[model samples]
Target: MNDHLVILIRSFSAFFILMIIGRILGKQTLSNMNFHEFVTAVILGAMAANFAFNEKIEVIHLLIALSVFTITSYVLAKLFLKFRSFKMWTEGTPTVLIEGGLILEDNLKKNNMTLDSLNQQLREKDIFNVEEVEYALLEINGKLSAQKKKELQAVTLKDLQLNAGNAPQFPIELVIDGQLLHGNLDSNHISESWMNSQLKARGKKLEDVFYAVKGSNGQLYVDDYKDNIQHPIDME
Candidate 1:
C-alpha cells in the first residue's frame, strides 16, 4: 500500500471514530463547555489528532482510548451529583462579588475578575451604577446574576398598587400534528365540539394548526401552519 493512502485511511478512520465518541459524550460536555470539560475535550482531540495520519494506528487502540474517556466522564459526573463537596470541587460554587451596594473587590480578585469586567457584567444586567445593585454573584457556570436594591428595582403593576383581580383562563390546545391530547381537554370538560368552536372563531380548523397546547391557567397557545407566528389567547 502507498504510504499516502495508509495515512489517509488512518486519518479518516480516526476522524469518524472521534466524532462518534464525542457525540456519545453528550451535549453537557459541549454546550456549557465548563473548564474541566473543555480540557477533557482538548485532550481527547490531541489524542485523536496524533493518530489521525499515522500508519501504525489501530482501531483497537482508538476504541480503548475512547472507552476510557467516556467511562471517566460518566464516573465523575455521577460522583459529583452524589456528593455536595465533590460537586463543589468539580463545578465550583458561586462567589458573591457584591453585597448590599458594596463591591467585594477581594472576591472579584480571587475569581480573577477585573474591575472593568465587573462593570461590564453589571451593565449587562442593566445595573450601570454599583450603588443600584444589592447583590451580585459569579455563578459556577461563569455567568453573573445580580439583584437590584428594593427601591431600585423596577416597579410592576402590583407595585403601583393596582387592585387587578384574578387572571382569566387562557385557552390551551389539546392537539398537535394530528394527534389528540385527550388528557389536556378531558378534565376541563372540553371536547372536539368546544375545540371546533374555538378554531372557527379564529378562522381556523383543528387540522390547520401545526401545534397547540393548553397552558397551566387553562389558556390555549397555538402556532398555525408553522409560519413562525405565535398567537396568544385572550379570554375575557
Candidate 2:
C-alpha cells in the first residue's frame, strides 16, 4: 500500500473511533466542558492523534487510553450530578463581583480579573455604568450575571398596575423561504384559507412571499423576495 493511502486509512479509522466514543460518552463532552472535562478532552485528542499517525504505537494501547479517559470523564460527570459538594469543588462557585453597587476588588483579584475587564463585561450586558448595578456575579462558566438597580430597571406592566390580558403567545411562522409550514399553522390553530386571505389582503400570493409570520398581536407580517426601495435617490 502507498504511504499516503496508509496515512489516509489511519486518519479515517481514528475519526470513526472517536465518533463512536463520543456517542457513548454523550453530549457532556461536547458542550460546556468544565476544567477536568476540558483536560480529558485534550488528552484524548492527543492520544487519538498519536494512534492515527505513529506506526510504532500499537492501536490497542491507544484504544485503552482513550477508553480510560472517556470512562473517567463519564464517572466524574455522574459524581458531579450526584454530589453537590463535589460539583462545587470541580466547577468552582460563583464569585460575587458587585454587591449593593460596590465592587469587590479582592474577589476580582482572586479570580485574576481586572477592573477594566469587569467593566467591559458589564458593557457587553448593556450595563454602561457600574453604579446602576445592584448585584453582579461572576459565574463559573466565566459569564457575568448582573442585576440592575430598581431605579435603573425598565418599567414593567406590574409596576404600572395595568390590567394586561392573558400572556401573549409567541409568533407562529407561517412560511419560510416560500415553503408553507403546515405543522406550525396546525399547531397554532390556523387554517390554510385564513393564511391565503391574509396574503390576498396584502396583494401577495403564497408563492411570492419569502417569509410570513403570524405575530402574537394577531398581525400578519410578510416579506417578499425582492426589495422594494421607496427612498428618493439623491442625484447631487
Candidate 3:
C-alpha cells in the first residue's frame, strides 16, 4: 500500500472514531468540558493524532486505548452524579477564597492562587476592591464566583420603596404556540372561561396567540402569532 493512501485512510478513520466517541460521551461533557472532560479531551486528541500519523502503532491498539478512556470518562460522570465521595475525590470541592469581605490567605495558598490573581479575577467580575466581596469561591472549573456585600449590591424596586407586586403565576404558560395548556390552567386554579374572556377583551382568539403567560405581576400577557410588523429589527 502507498504511504499517502494509508495516511489518508487512517486520518479519516481516526476522525470518524473520535466523533462517535464524542457522541457516546454525551453533550454535557463536550459542551461544559469539566475537569474530567478536559483530561479526556487532551488524551483522546493525542491518541487520535498518533493513530493518524504514527504508522508504527497498530490501529487495534489505538482503538482499544480510545475505547477504554471514553468508557472511563462516561462511567465517571455517572458515578459522580450518584456518589458524592467519589466525585470529591476526582474533582475537589469548591474552596472559599473570601468570607465576610475578608480574603482567606490560607485558602488562597491551598488553591495556589496569589493576591494579584484573586484581585484580577474579582476585577474581571467588576469588583475593583476586595472589601466589596461578601463571599468568594474558587469553583472546580477554575472560575471565581463572588457575592457582593449588601451595601455594594444593586438597589431594586424594594430598596426604592416602590410597590412591585410579586408574580405567583409567574412562568405560567397558559398558551404556547396557539396551544393552551389545560393542565397548567387547572393546576393554577384558572379556568378556560377566564382565558376566553381575556382573549375576547383583546379582540383575539386562541389561535391568534403565539405565546401567553400569567406574569409574576398577576397580569395576563399575550403575544400575537402574526406580529403584523412591516419592519422588525432582529438583534441577532
Candidate that scores best on TM-score: 3
Better of 1 and 2 by lDDT: 2
The segments of candidate 3 whose C-alpha lies over 4 angstroms from its true place after superposition are: 158-236
Give the best candidate by lDDT. 3
Candidate order, lDDT descending: 3, 2, 1
Residue 199, model 2, lDDT: 90
- Write the number of the candidate with greater lDDT, choosing between 2 and 3: 3
Q: Estimate each model's TM-score.
A: 0.57, 0.61, 0.62
Candidate 2 ranges beyond 4 A from true positions: 159-236
Q: Candidate 2, residues 1-236: lDDT per residue as tens digits? A: 88778778888988898888777777756766678877887887887798778877887888888889988988988887656568878789788898778899999999999999999999999989899988889987788999887666687776466434534334678987677888888977899999998899889898898889977456789999876778858553
Overlapping backbone residue pairs in candidate 2 total: 0
Sort order, TM-score high to low: 3, 2, 1
**Model 1, TM vs. native:** 0.57
Writing each residue's lDDT as its tens digit, candidate 1 over 110-224 gives 9999999999998887778988887788987788998777666676875566333434233455776645667667876788777778778888877788777766335567777
lDDT of 3 by residue, 1-236 (tens): 99999999999999999999988988777566678899999999999989899899898899889989999999999998766568879898788898767889999999899999999999999999888888898988888998887666687875466343421222477987687889889988999999999999999999999889986446799999799899999653
